[model samples]
Target: MRLSNLIPSIPANVVACLEVQGIRTDTDLLFSTTTFDIYKRLPAGTATLEELTEYTTIAAEIGAAPGMSGHELLLLENTYGDVQLRTGNAELDGLLRGLDGRWIIELSGDKGSGKSTVALNLLINHLASNLEDTALWIDTTCDFSPERATQFLDATQTLPSTLERLQVSLAFDIDTIQGILETLSRPNDPRARPRFLVIDTITPLLGPLLSAVSAQGHAIMTDFMRQLQTFAQASGTAVFVINNSSRKGRDTPERKPALGPSFALLTDTTLWLEAKNDNNTEDSTEDNTVHTMQILKSRSAPIGGCCTFRIHGNVICPT
Candidate 1:
């Protein structure tokens, strides 16, 4: 019964999740058929039968041992009120807290700016912080693949509970898109019960919702946003709406970002993603690619301040 036997057959991820619940050591695990199935699949014997028995017995004992601890719960006191903003970036984490009630974190930039990577990184971190809260991610396009998510988890060192908290609605229809969010916002829905929502690339959903012209588009936009805002406020949930920038034409550097003015008004914060070329093609010192991000509109903090980040596989790192 060597510890090494538990290596492959059992997904490190399963054990990892339990570890976050303060069940770090193997002795803390609650033994059950699920545990046996997982470990049995590993090499013949990782830990001796005696060791496994002891671990399970302790797990059951700990389970019966409790009143709740206050820290594990999320801050839902603001449920259905104003949206609050917090930066996942440790650097700005302190600077940004409770900035606004309705926030929009827009990730934009040329290709490979690590825009999606950053979004996933923040989410993983958020999940690790609130393991009990259930969260939903609506991917209008198939962009939000689980494989990609796993990569990000490893990179950010996100806990298993955080990863499990997420329930993704993949490749949804144009019409059925917002319904995913609306339904989750419903009081009884388990996923939305935690008040966390993420609509990756909301444009696809907007396609069906937008009306004929300028005025109509504006009306639909506002009403739609209002629903999101109201639901977010009432529920104490943190929503991350990720979007891409358009290729309207790069006339001016200042006008690089492409977002409708009306749409911008509804958000409490916006982050613009951009790429900083470091390849030898232009200035060949290091054959590396660097993506830069900027706080386009904080509505509460410094503007134009840029931060460089990297998405190596699923991990987003400070470049």
Candidate 2:
């Protein structure tokens, strides 16, 4: 909290000037008075009003959450790495090297590929493991089904009260989802904070923004994605965003994530889901289909790790 901690950001002379005014810590710089007042109190030309404003902004950010050193970050990973959140399927969890901590995991696939099924499975498994833990599901397509979630919860033997911890919000626009993220990023009771957040098909919310005539939409999309990363890091919550796939290029049958290349870099990992066969084969039951979830991108784990599973009676089962 020492004013020197913001060195290089707040110039040495500026820090000295502020220190002369008894504004030593970030809290003092922020709470002593408005940024303009601080500028007025400073010796003429010691620092510009614009410069003073920028310094205070940086101070506020540091106060909210300071940067993590490399060693500290390594320790954090080691601590949370052992407690990966299950995808509700053992094989799938092992295949992806286990998901943990504050990172974005994207699920992208075509319609009928069972993206929602996988998301619900993950949410139920997380909520069932602990009674006090909470999760948020932002439904963008109005396709989130409580009946399907009920099936998953039942399979996990999640207590009836666990359902209370899984809160779902219908968000069809970027603003609504952004507001939700901002709200979650604020300080709250540790037990009340959500440990996992799912945006069921982010495609609906971001697709138009990326396809607009003006280039401003792209900027908006970038800002929103960064906001997501900030929220994840601030709260140590694992974010899962679902996306729909599109053809890799205009003249190709191969498919890729729909949000384009920028979005790919924004997420920590991307999982592509494909349904090999959805129809009931002669050997299969009425409600069963073999699906493969493949890792498209990862920082720590190797890419292209594909795991197979099936939806039997709405429950995801490892093959």
Candidate 3:
């Protein structure tokens, strides 16, 4: 809806000022720009915080104004109503209760730990489902394989139409990555809005600078993560960020994510994946390699619980 229509009571001059700032619609005002930013764009002495808050409240109400009652929301929660997509692995699905669009899920693991494989599976499942949702994948590792995705599609017998719904982009640096995310955060077309966003190995883009304790790097990282979180909350898009793990010590058993504790704390849910056996030899074979996914943190469910799954020909399956 147009901004003018949503806030008809606002002065025409103020609305025109907002329009001049490229915020002509409610979606643009709410998702594309911040209130303080918008206020700065308006004419002097014409904008007020109270007015901006009112406009935001109205926009939010309009977005969720489907007349859903408290009891109905409760009923939906009982039926896993918030689940937007499934991983197809029963045990993993049970642990995650399916992917919720409202939360950010972080998948961190050691090298060759099937983080990309699991993310690709989720994208495939999201598009293959009956919902009208679409997905956006940002590949930073340059390892996203369409051929492997095709393997998944062929396995599930999904038509070519499903593949068409998945949009993919590659970003090699922090600036490019942030640009892609910011663009997705305020999509111009409603149909083009993504329901799922996947960033493969986010740590690689920011890890080096962060490790060196670069203040500028930290500032950029902070802005990027904050924008990402805001986008997830405002758009209700399920986000999956792949992070690489760092071995703590040669003798120590613990491994930490490359993004470190600060980044981990920002996510709503964190899943850490590791190979089950450290003693497994090179001839262990693909089928013999079992990975365990443990919930390091979760806001809506019990933590410390884990599930085991294996990767077989691009498919993540419960063992």
Candidate 4:
């Protein structure tokens, strides 16, 4: 459980800082501290978000930490006030407790699995519910539609004002995505920061790079994830990243999410959405398609928890 042995590639400065703080082993980090606690112990301005994230990732991988007890976790939640952005779906909300601002939420699915629809619903819901709060939507796939946003708000009659608060940015490449994230990291006005951030299908934007040259792609993705972690932590902004799923063969047990373990490990929650066949029953007549969302991995909730829902009009509701 030595920190150096567990993550050999850990930055030298981070290792030195950990040693100086007497945190030579994984248990030293786990028993009496949180990642932030460790970060505070590091030399001022020497620890980067990426380094701390890598440390925690190794901790999880090596099972050095058993996680916080219920009491401690509950105390933390109480301090944070349990504030979250609602998904506009009651059942989904009940399962997820809403999109939490303290962690990243990753949604992975194949094309036509209602990922974008759900993201848009959350954006519209947040803008409608909180008039002063705004949202930033980074569309990499060019699938975001203003018309759909307007349609979602038509029922609530808050389209005009909600649209004003919803900021849209198109990032066609990795550089653009990185630049946008950087801009968010250093907001001109703290009050103008968005309540939540969305990147629809981050895989599509980074997939080609990984396919062409994996090492360079992984480096870029790692930096992107680090920037995202920093931005979310600093701003307390709820981040929702949509990803594509790798197709599975008939013999494969299940489909896997793209971007490999590094990206997967970066997220706090990973939800996999798969389209279900039409049952053709009385309830089935209400919607065109039903989606089964599996809680593949979660740090706060029980893993393997799942729910079924359908997209009716523009809103996602449990079936």
TM-score of each: 0.62, 0.74, 0.70, 0.69
lDDT of candidate 4 over 104-180, digit per residue (tens): 88989888777888878877887677777778999887888887777777755665776888888988876676666
Local distance difference test, candidate 4: 0.73
lDDT of 3 by residue, 68-87 (tens): 56786566445433435577
| All candidates: CA RMSD (Å) | 18.1, 8.9, 7.7, 11.1
- After superposing candidate 3, which stretches have Cα over 4 Å from the reference? 1-83, 188-191, 211-213, 250-253, 278-284
State residue 5's C-alpha deviation in candidate 3, in Å. 28
lDDT of each: 0.55, 0.78, 0.74, 0.73
Between candidates 1 and 4, which one is better according to TM-score? 4
Q: Which candidate, 1 or 3, would have the higher lDDT against the true structure?
A: 3
- C-alpha RMSD (angstroms) for model 2: 8.9
Model 1 misplaced stretches (Cα beyond 4 Å)? 1-89, 92-102, 171-175, 188-192, 207-214, 247-255, 279-289
Better of 3 and 4 by TM-score: 3
Summarize candidate 2's per-residue lDDT along 118-221 as a digit string, tens digits. Answer: 87777777777755578899988888888877776677676777788888999978877876765665554333468788998788778877764777678777
Clashes of 2: 0
